[model samples]
Target: MPKYPAREPLVLLPCRLPASLVARFAERAREQGVTLSDVLRAHLTVDEAKPLGKAVPRKRAGLAKVSGADPKLLRQLVGMGNNLNQIAKLANIASKTAQPMAMVELLITLKGIEKSLEKLSES
Candidate 1:
């Protein structure tokens, strides 16, 4: 049996399909060097057509103009950002290799936020 990602589950979603149709997709999967599951997941989008995977990075929006922004409010925003960063760092260290799925999701979310902050700082 092939091994999947350690963080992912071995989900078996069974459904009826004609043998010929399954063979067709299997052939395509072989030619494409990807699993039949990947092909089907990408092809089907009835529920919601969310993109399958990571998005192409976009150029940062650049910081919003703050020429007339309140000074105290701006300082508070910066402080909040610093606090969030510290929390993320602590979470990273506290969640070990065998962390639960929920913790992994939290880390992913924190990582995304960190990336957003990084792009914001670029401007």
Candidate 2:
């Protein structure tokens, strides 16, 4: 009986490409004296350790400008937001360390913020 060496399993990756692109790839492979599969594999191979390039910024939809809004109310809302953020950070830290947070105070602050937003919208 003859024994054969084990071979790694191969997977079939079926892909559809335009005829023009396929022809270009074939021509490049012939020029380089390599198979079309080799050319495609070389192009598809990525270096896992290499960091990615900077991302391109996408155009975003512009927000509508709020006309005739009270500047003082906006400032107050901004201050409230800052306070809420601080409380949330503390609450998160406490929860992670198995400590209790002032849940009632947080709820009340949230409600106040909601009411302020409604008032701003009405004006």
Candidate 2 per-residue lDDT, tens place, 1-123, comes to 122355855467999989999999999999999888778766764563367899999976433235454667667777888988987887677667765446656667778888877997797
Clashes of each: 0, 0
Candidate 1, residues 14-111: lDDT per residue as tens digits?
99989999999899899899989877766665666675697789876433453566666577568768878786776776675556775767678778
Residue pairs of candidate 2 with colliding backbone atoms:
none
Every model: Cα RMSD to truth? 15.0, 13.0
lDDT of 1: 0.73
Off by over 4 Å in 2: 1-70
User: What TM-score against the true fold does each predicted structure earn?
Assistant: 0.30, 0.35
Q: Show where candidate 1 strays beyond 4 Å.
A: 1-10, 47-123
What lDDT would each prediction earn against the true structure? Answer: 0.73, 0.74
